[model samples]
Target: MSKIIFVNLPVSDLNASMAFYEALGFENNPQFTDDTAACMVWSEAIFVMLLTHDKWKTFTNRPISPITTSEVMLCLSCESREIVDELNDTAEENGGTADINPKQDHGFMYNRNLADLDGHVWEMMWMDPAAMTN
Candidate 1:
């Protein structure tokens, strides 16, 4: 089987978290979703597992970080700069915070940061495919 990536994040509220991700355009995979966890599918190969605190604790002994601090930042690539802006705007409309970091535009690439309701950072980006060959 091909390898796939699943980003598991601890969220205070499962339903709210699911809504937040859905707003960013990810579809929920009911095959692996329930009250305690929601399998949000970004693509066939990329999924984000939103787990409630109790469900998350099952996979770790470490304490959950307070909302004031971030343990990691997740980045998603968009087909164009406009899509990045659209997603970021949707995130803000769905109770997320947009622009945690200043926008970065290197001509060939652009990105903006947003914080989910639980304070996890999601960076939306766009890159020119031709730029990678230069």
Candidate 2:
């Protein structure tokens, strides 16, 4: 069986968070969603679990990281540089902060950083397949 990754995030507002991800093309799996938690599928293999503060405590006793601080920055790949830009633009329109870090463009690869409403950062990138062969 192929391995699948589930990234669990603590959210301040479950409904808002779900909407934010939905704006970026993530689909919610109602079978795994409830008042306290939501399952957002980014792809067949990548799933993000958005949990409320109270629900988060059940899995870990660690204090919720402040919105001003970043514990980790998650990265996702786009099909093209244009797609990267579009996703970042959508994020900004949906309450996310876009370009939290300076954009990176290396001819072969391009990237932009966006932070969700709860301050979780996502690095959207695109790489040239032709460049990989050279």
Clash list (residue pairs), candidate 2:
none
Per-residue lDDT of candidate 2, residues 6-54 (tens digit): 9999999999999999999999999999999999999999999999999
The list of candidate 1 runs beyond 4 A from truth reads 132-134
> Which residue runs of candidate 2 sit more than 4 Å off their true CA positions?
132-134
TM-score of 1: 0.95
Q: Could you estimate the TM-score for every candidate?
A: 0.95, 0.96
Q: lDDT per residue, candidate 1, 4-103, as tens digits?
A: 9999999999999999998888999999999899999998899999999999999999998998898798888899999999988998899999998898
Whole-model lDDT values for every prediction: 0.92, 0.96
Instruction: Name the lDDT value of residue 93 in candidate 1.
Output: 96
* lDDT for residue 99 in candidate 1, whole number 0-100: 91
